[model samples]
Target chain A: MTGETVMFWVLAPLTVFAAVGMLLVKKAVHSAILLAFVMIALAIFYIAQDAPFLGIVQIVVYTGAVMMLFLFILMLVGVDSSDSLVETIKGLRGVAITTSLAFAAALTSLIARAEFGQEPLGLVSANANGNVEGIANLIFRQYVWAFEVISALLITAALGAMVLAHSPKSSEARLSQRARSVARFRGASIGTAAGLPGSGVFARHNAVDVPALLPDGKPSDLSISSVLAERGDVQETKRYALDGLPKLDEEDK
Target chain B: MTEYASLLLDDPIWLVAVKALLIFVLCVLLTLLAIWGERRIVARMQLRVGPNRVGPFGLVQGLADGVKLALKEDLIPKAADKVIFIIAPIISASTCFLAFAVIPMTGKVLFFGEETVFQLTDLSVGVLYILAAASVGVYGIVLAGWSSGSTYPLLGGLRSSAQVISYEIAMGLSFVAVFMYAGSMSTSEIVDSQAQWWNVVVLFPSFVIYVISMIGETNRAPFDLAEAEGELVGGFHTEYSSLKFALFFLAEYVNIMAVSALATTLFLGGPAAPPGLSFTESWLGGWFTFIWFILKVALFFFLFVWLRGTLPRLRYDQFMKFGWKVLIPVNIAWILIVATLRLMTQEGASQFMLAGFIITVVVLVMLATTIYESSKAKAEAAARFVPEMPEPSFPVPELPKQKRVEL
Candidate 1:
């Protein structure tokens, strides 16, 4: 077998596995990651088929921007929010299975009946002037109108998203930085006027989880983030204490 | 097809393997040097001696650091997803090296009695391949953040992903001009097309946009919001320790080199000798071209270090705004002008006419910018002129009715 066929045999099963894994994965983040893998594998297939331009675009546009955005939203929405098995719509699973099966069968039949006039003609001749140039000629010359229409459509979609996402600014006067600072100092207590002390400011260990030590040799509750404290991720300060140094009382004596 | 691509295609399997290995080693070595160079250069810029105690001139300081990092205790946070946490760095480190595959690092040179270029392979879509590799690299940081199962890392990861996405658009837009001018995306062809004048001179705006975009792309300062130490702790690698953290560090530096090399290839003319130094191209059996390439990359590397030393990190909102609102629009406008110029040249426009066209475009752009700035300033001034300040009103609670008796 040729190297291309060998590579195809190696990658096809993995791509399929990853695609299937995306659905089976419990976590949305993992699903997104698996989808990225599938996209990358498809990109390789494109490259192997002599469509290097499309292959790279598959990677740049799909795996890169699109999948990254998917993962980004997943992170924002909380990655731990796993899929719910409970169907929200009545007979949804049945409908999904039936449609998927029908689609698969149609795809199989289409592939089976596909005709090859002779030995397949590769893109070598078309890409003689370089893949990008060849594609550009098609895009800018023959199919320019179609390309322009597609671009217009994309721009419209982008604009639509912008309009939907945008919210009008509040009518109330916004506080300037100076005003905010002045208000901060004048509020309930000025104890934290400058700012709340950062975690591990005066601690032996300066890790984020290590709470700073107060003057009386006690850990300050306000030093570490409340989230971290709530989660019980804070490190024990006893081991990190500067025991080698003389005590304050002894120094005073 | 370019000479380099054709040559690369004819390379036997063993030669391909050797070239791939060579590229991998080169990247790793460059990463090490980059790390040390960044520290040393930044230190000198700040008037401090850096890493002087390590091997000669601290040349092997990065190696020392690698060893130290590997030997350090590895920690996996209790909450982290184990499998993904391990894979994240591998993906990052691997993809950075992948970008090097298409970058022409030298002129045609003899290696082991076979003629080859100092590159793994050159795709017809070479520039796109580099960009694709870079995009894939984002997954490393994102996965690192997500799998860490921590707030800081997660926030860092999201910020990085967003930053990369926005900047990648501007970066791609900048490349549009280069592609239009060169008429090819292959790195070698682009380099060859710049025989007389580099893209940096002809496509100055694209170069500027690309340089800015690349800094943001690699997550370097002042665009290094991904690892903003103050706010996000260690950012996406907050929970990473030992070798995993080292991998991220290696990937970060290697990515810087990758982008720098790309900048060299696209704008500076990859592996080409500087002006008035044409004779040097024949030196060392064309291996000198590799040296020239490295010098160009080093120039960019120094720029990265200088920026890191000089500029403070940009606020995340401002950085994002700059990328999307400013850089991208400017890039698109530049591409339009470039495309028009390319078309004019293709249609045999005279030098006088071309010069006049360029002058007209520049003047119009300048005039528009001035007008926009003035209008923005006027709006700001008008907004600042508030008529009066409202009385500060805060909610107050009344004392309990029976409080006096209770007290």
Candidate 2:
């Protein structure tokens, strides 16, 4: 087989495997990353097919921008928050499975009916006048209206996102309340700061920026979620404890 | 000499491999040289004696550093996702190298008694390919940061990805003018189009925008908030050590070189000689064109170092605001103006009509900008009015005055 064919065989399976992995992964972050792999594989397939412009666009727009956004949100939200198994909508799973299977069957049938060996219709070869030009010619000359409509749809989506994200009045009220609290804090005496300091036996660290260290030299707070802590997700050792060495077993003694 | 050189047209597989290998080596060497050059230049600017121990004037300091990195013990944070953590640097380094494939290093040159181009490979969508590689490079950083299972690294990765995406839009828009004028996305064709005059001379606005966006795109100083030492520690690679850390560092320098090479290819005219230098053609032969390309790239590298030494990092919010609110809008406006001008010229419109159209567009744009600025000022004035709140009273302690002493 030619190198291109070899590449296709390798990438196609990898893409499918990654897509499956994305669904199977319990961690949302892992799923997002797997999706990126799938995207990159698809981009390579586009390049193998000589659709250089499309391939690059796939990487740039989907794998790069979209997947990064997904990963960013996933990281910010933390990884301990797994999706609940409880179904919010009754019978939704059954409905989803049925629709998915029907769609799959229809797509398979369509693909089986298509003539794979024939030259593509209404599309110039990528190398003829260069891929960019060929694509541009089609978009501008033939599919101009569709292109403009898609762009309009995109703009509308952006506007909708802005409207959804905006909450000006509530935000302003929250900001004012925060300002009032800051003002109140500024007026309070040093001793009254942090709302009645811990008892002398449990004195907190004086520095505001650093995490408070307990008297025994352990960090007072863990930044990770409680769920993660319960699952033993904390990797770094809390402290070096010389006294915590295991006592001799009773049987051995 | 050929006006333009096409790439990978029926070349043997062995020849293609050789070209790829050559470009890879060249990029690696350039990155190392750039590192040493940056340190020396920045030191000179700061009036200090830089590294001089490794080789004459510290030329081999980068190599020494590389060896040290290789010998050092590799450390992976226990919390890290092992698979993604390992692949992150590989992705970064590979993508950085990939961008060079489309950069035209020289026009046709004699190689084994056959005419060949001095580029690894070129695609019809050459500029887009470079852009794609750059975009993909962001994944390396983001994944590294996320897989580290650390807060700062995650933040850094997110910032870097956002910064790249925002600036890329402006960068792509800036290229619209160049593409319109050159009539091709192929690097060699763009270079050939600039034989008479460089794009920087005629398309000054696009040139300026591209330079600014390129700086942002590469995460260089004034736009390097992603890895800001004061805020994010080592940023996305905070947990990486040894060869992995070295790979991240290598990727950064390689990215700088790739971006500089791209800037050279796009605006400065890839491997073409400067307009007034006829002596190069007669005395130095056509191969001397590569020198011109390297010199242009080096100039950009110098600019990067200069900015790093001079400027303070911008605040993250302000950086984002400037990118999304200012650069992108300005780039779009500029593209529209350029498109109209190209259309007018292509239509062979009369000089009067062309001038009239230009004036009308400029006036309308100015009017719109002025109105927007006025409204923005008004909004700022309104938002500055914070509601006054009564001050709370608190008891204070007094200290006794100390005894006075003679000065």
**Candidate 1 C-alpha lDDT tens digits along A1-253:** 9999999999999999999999898988888888999999998998888888889899998888888878778788885788778999999999999999999999999999998878855677788776777888999999999999999999999999999999988999786665556555666535456666678854565478887655445555567798987898977656544445545445555
What candidate 1 gets wrong by more than 4 Å, as runs, is A89-125, A172-253, B350-356, B386-407
Winning candidate number (DockQ): 1
Question: Residue-wise lDDT of candidate 2 within A104-152, one digit each (tens)?
Answer: 9999999989887966654455457766778888899999999999999
Give the docking tier of candidate 1.
Answer: incorrect
**What local lDDT score does residue A102 receive in model 1, on the 0 to 100 scale?**
100
TM-score of each: 0.83, 0.82
Most accurate candidate by TM-score? 1
Query: What are the per-residue Cα lDDT tens digits for candidate 2 across B1-407?
Result: 12444335756777878888888899889988988999999999999978888988899999999999999999988888899899999999999998888788876676555567778776777898888888888889888988898789988888887898899989988898999999887787788788888999989999998999899998889899998999999888888999999999999999999889988998998877788884674344467878888999999999999999999899999988988898888888888888888998899989998999889987998899899999998766655545455555433322234334689
Listed models, DockQ each: 0.20, 0.19
